[model samples]
Target: MSDKRRAFESPADLARPITQPVLRRPAATTMGAVLVVLRVLAGVWWLLALTFSWNDVLLDDLGLGDEPDFQALGNDVKEAISSGILNTVLIVGGIVLVIELLFALLVFRGVNWARVVVMVFATLSIIGSFVGWWLGGQEITVHTTLVTLALDILVLLALSSQGARAYARRPRERRARGSVA
Candidate 1:
């Protein structure tokens, strides 16, 4: 018989292994829990700012309070404040509240990027607070300043903990394993 080899192909050649990546939840750590609490506090801070302080600061302090030019507009000024200006302030405040809650949840989930983001924001807040106190000569009570600074420092420390770092890397580790043969 003439030596001829037909194309050797099996059904296995057509079938490919489908790799489904498994999702692993990192072990919960004390540092992570502390971060969660801090994040929740941050969210609450925003909630209070929006619900209580926004109107007072926007309408009374910064708005038409002592503006002589606004006095000429009179009734129109009242109408504008009642309609567009107040609505815009409320809208902006609501957006800030939403962002605060979302970031807090992300940080609580041990997202490394979220941790960095929150730390950067906290640092900025601290700087802004100090600058406002110094430059604006705003009379901020020692207790209020100290409490805010303490919360920010604690959040920074908790996010920098060894356990938090490991927890953040777990997703990357899973991805690495899934990519290998």
Candidate 2:
């Protein structure tokens, strides 16, 4: 067979095992494993926030009392929830959680896109978290937000490393070749 045709051989014919050194060095594996743990924890927090908020809004039904405007906003939110606005919130929150989980899984797989995606998402979340903490007027939330922001910054920095950048770029390279007519 010609060399070009040999390259396109059936899977059965190409089944010979070829030993290769591990691509990820020990340090990279250790660092990546730590990042995966952090990513999973963050993902869980966001996922739980969605469900927790949904449950609180659904069961407690605190529209006015929870608002800064007290009675007026509370009454308005209550009315809105009663009128199905709460459903919209739940739907949106669910979508966000699902996307978060998808990113988490990708991070677990050491996918480069997950790093960029999660970094952007985490940054936005840090802003939202701070805003929510401030608006919440709760000391505990403020503390939590600070810790979360710190962790997110670390994750972004780690994902910006040479190894992470390479992982993310591999797919782009494949696409570039695939796109050539």
Candidate 3:
């Protein structure tokens, strides 16, 4: 009882606190930088496709023809342009183009949110491209399609990295934890 009392009277020896996480800042920075670069490049590519092929893609092809019918294509394009779908497509597409350009700018500046937005849109765009290719049954070279798909996948993977996601989550993370990430 005396020994117990003496031991109890002595100051308690608490376990040492857990060590802080040794953050790999360099790795995070490198990954984040790569994601930004990929985002900018992919965004520019997408913007160009959206701009140059807007009519050919949405109007002349999908809106008018079954596949390679020039007459149907012309009629559809003419009707679309005259019947107001052209203006609607142009307006919406213009807005998207401007937003994408802004996103590209932000990504170049290492903005994580812009990277996330780019990734989302890039993924959707790639899917749409695939669907269009399939529907049109256009005889594209396998090598070209494969290369394009591979590049798109790489961009997506880079943007979806832990570091990129973490950076993007910075604001929300900070808000949730009541401190800056």
Candidate 4:
């Protein structure tokens, strides 16, 4: 070996693997996660509204007019409709809420796939809302519809931010290096 090459020896552990550290979660990602949680809260609001006002909601949904005399129906019919509406709401609403919660948690963890999934859902929701409104099928109330729309918009903006996207799409080595406690 030449004198320069023999001047120093390489570290014995140079070939061994060394874990890299993962950077902290970005603010935009945190915001996106929080926005998702807000969406879940909106879902809860709808569930509660349906739970408390199933009769009026059922009437409105079924085109029974704003002030239908629903009480005039026979007891059996009333009970049947009431139970059906409540049961449907509970089943469907509960499932959606759980799924939203799971996605929110996943987004908070900086999972790229989760972020993309949320973005897709948000886009769909925005488009569907506009389409339904244009067709005179969906109502956009200030208290309910508008609030949820805002949440979805915010979620999209946050998750689609440069910082959020970079952090979420970061290499697996960076992500896994410091993931363990």
Best candidate according to TM-score: 4
Off by over 4 Å in 1: 1-60, 142-148, 171-181
Worst lDDT run of 10 residues, candidate 3, spans 9-18
Q: Pull out the clashing pairs in model 1.
A: none
Model 4, residue 91: distance off in Å is 1.6
Candidate 4 yields a Cα-based lDDT of 0.81
Could you give candidate 1's per-residue lDDT for residues 19-73 as a string of tens digits?
4322443333345445545555655565566556654665586776567776677
lDDT of 3 by residue, 46-81 (tens): 555655666566646565544456454566666665
What tens-digit string does per-residue lDDT give for candidate 2 at 115-175?
6777787678667767776897645343255555776667666665545544444432235
Query: Each candidate's TM vs. the true structure?
Result: 0.61, 0.48, 0.43, 0.75
Residue 63 displacement in candidate 4 (angstroms): 2.5
lDDT of each: 0.60, 0.57, 0.55, 0.81
Off by over 4 Å in 4: 1-22, 64-73, 174-181
Give candidate 4's error at residue 115 in angstroms. 0.5
Backbone clash pairs for candidate 2 read 63-74, 64-74
Score candidate 2 by TM-score against the native. 0.48
Clashing pairs in 4: none
